[model samples]
Target: MFRCARAFSTSPLFKYAAMTCRQYSFQVFRDVPPLRQMRRQLLLDRKTVGFVPTMGALHEGHLSLIRQAATENTDVFVSIFVNPTQFGVNEDLSSYPRTWDSDVAKLEELNDEFARLGGDTGRISAILAPTPKVMYPTLPPSSEVDGDGSFVTITPLSRKLEGASRPVFFRGVATVCMKLFNIVQADRAYFGQKDVQQTVVIKRLVQDFYINTDIVIGDTVREHDGLAMSSRNVYLGARRRAVGLVIYDALKAAENAYNSGKLARSEILDAANGVASRVLSEQQALSPSERALYEVDYISLADPDTLDEVETIDPSKGAIISGAVKMVPLEESKPGEDCGLGDGKVPVRLIDNLIFKPRP
Candidate 1:
């Protein structure tokens, strides 16, 4: 039982990240003009730059991406903008954990980590903490756009998976990423593999739009107990956290099935769904207010490239098995409050994925 007790809990590898962390000096660019100016300078100087774009709340998963960005680029730039265009009116964009100062502190700590490792260029050079006013300057920050300003949407692709749930997600992601990629114009940008769909979308965005930056994807970092690290994990209060392990367990079941040579999609999905079904069974045994309201959204087996749902595993070309479980905490349940991601409550959505590979 990997029963983690608190929020933001992580492995010992990050023992001193947010705690005992030294604040290193870095540029905090808040507007477009200055950030663009700095970027132009970087390009003129022919210095290799790496970009790591993020929403505020910093965690180990985020840091690992920055670490990779540092190792490859002469300068690294991070953006911490909680994009309003990304969230629907009913979503928890307002309550979506914004630890700004702490986030900067984490970046400082990361820069210092690189400094200790005997490298100067590995440190983050600046951050674009733009405001809603600054980011959405003229365009309205509403997902329900009336097609006024230019918006990016990769049809069909943006309409599936996470997009199917929040139709505006990938549009917002593409729009913001394109905007940031324009602003920073870093030689390469870093992203984590955990947000698999987003990674696919961004890669397509760059390819289709002819964006200059290279998209570098680092492996997903996990907690000591194996849950993929996420900013939203904080919402999984102690009790729900334990049950949340079921999300990963389900993915593991699918992984095990595939590795065991059950290459049929039905076999793999059945194995995964069987593990996830425990949530419903467990719900019957718990009190209403104490339960982690896990309403199964989807357990998917799809092509890694087009994301088209697969019926059978293609050994020559692998597939990605992913799942999403909407978890709402009854203890803090607000019947009317919604995060847009889940039911009409501040739901703690759990999503995870694992790769299936056969040994040679």
Candidate 2:
């Protein structure tokens, strides 16, 4: 039996702050020993663990997943490690948001709500937030492809859609997630649908590896204007932020065209491209300081499962119409600074998807 270092209060009203405000009783572990010890204790006590892995910078989307995990399992473990492996060399690993203190506060706020509503039997038992150094003491040097240590790769699936853009993305994602699953060994894992391809890859990872974890996908949460909630959304300036909605707008356009008996794949893609063109025209009309913020990456219909581009939509099998748009700040328009493709313009790639099922 693994002896845990600490024990949570069994009282129904667990408190951390004063009576003026409710507080959570969840513990945060930065190393593996105490985390594993606690996990062993929870499993020995017949608890069903639900895991929500994240890269910190908590938002409403992340909160929704945590709430679901806490509600569904005997014990919930939320890991907040920003896996370095998942980020490409040109990606925003360094610029990525790292609001750890605020993230804890958000989780604690949710815990307080759960407690207030008589949350019992299931609570956010602990947080597994190890640093990259601690999590990967022998982590290889970062590279666009083929990092230092061994990695988990899902062929074909890992090489499509988002994979085509960021080659090493799934390799890093699969590796870190595999390590996390091995550590938590949770009964259920929750993921948001915003990264549809990522969810697909993880589901495949769980199946191919024979890991006994149920992958639960939460719906994609969006802003009032339809921009998908994402940590990188912060990088979008005010003008670019508004323009980011083009991704969702384009996906909706494609879905509408498909539902209206436009089954030809080229026609649907053209509809989405038209929306992108309209967005570009609008951006071009803005002041130079606020113009040139939108860049369309790719828009297409794909097999919902394989993520492969399709020639025609099969009414029986729904397809995912997804588009990616890269938005940059206006002020970063310099000769060698941010204008060129993949330059350090601090571009934010916004992606959105819609499931198109032909109506009978």
Candidate 3:
């Protein structure tokens, strides 16, 4: 009898063990199915993707866009391609920073936080990482025909300021960005306001081509000293760094004049020029190298939307006073030193914008 009891309790213990194992297995299976189903659903749903295309030495300006993208869309994709096509033969394409690994790491960290927030788990599915060839496929024999025949070429607006100088600059930017849009199929894209001209061009391109992606312009990031944050700032030495302030100081002078009721476009330009001239004159005593490596390219008050030069300030309409400055190399500097184009000196373009609202 005892033996029978032992068999029932011990030898038959396999049955009890099996029951417990089944329960544990069922729990494990239950946990997995939900998770798998959730993941599957996530994969199936069409996620709203956001894109921020940059030349990659990531900064707060870029991060601001990423954060904005995270808040607005289910997925955020960043492209770090430093497109060669966009840069003119004489431009700083080679010197442009290419901090790819750092950029990816930053994005990954943002993505992790985004995922934890129950924001899209797929918030940043892929970097849309591609080589220039992949992004800009093979073109036809003629340089005119871009790699893809269906390529978009945005012009007309390309005839202004920066465009006037860097002829093919916008085309390069437009093409690559469009290619990125095609690859990622982002529902929305972000850009910095600092590139006012670029912003204008991208907006026009999307509208003209009927590209479906929505473009968002983030505010320009600036240094505490008021210098606009740019990757090229790294080239500035200590003296040049201090001189850089002249750009903002000049803009502020214009702003002060406007605030003090200097409504005439000429007066505003004069104010800006005055400030810049005074600062430049003082720096001139220092060696040529000590002078701010920037020279007035042009200063004009213009219609904000159309970007056409305006004769006077119309309080009813907003206007922008924008221009570029070329850094002049010291004596012994080559012939092209003063101009941003063709070799002598690198240019640091400075633009300042303000709005004059009509008195109520």
Per-candidate TM equals 0.87, 0.87, 0.76
Write down the worst ten-residue block by lDDT for model 2.
Answer: 12-21
Per-model clash counts, in order, read 0, 0, 4
Candidate 2 on 1-360: residue-level lDDT in tens? Answer: 222223332222222222222234777676787788878988898989999999988898988888888778978889887787778888877777777568878877887788787745377878887656666777553645855687899999998888889898899899889989999999999999988889989999999999989999898889998888998877665556776788898888888888788888989998889989998898787777656567787886898888889998888887888877777656544354333323435778888788786456
**Tens digits of per-residue lDDT for model 1, 51-167:** 999987889999999999989987889988778777766777766876765787788788778888875447788877766666677866777744456678887888878888887
lDDT of 3 by residue, 110-192 (tens): 76677678834436544443445445457521123233343456667676767777777777888777777655567789998
lDDT of each: 0.78, 0.79, 0.63
The number of clashing residue pairs in model 2 is 0
Where is model 1 more than 4 Å wrong at Cα?
Answer: 1-24, 145-147, 331-345, 357-360
TM-score of 2: 0.87
Residue 22, model 3, lDDT: 17
lDDT of 1: 0.78
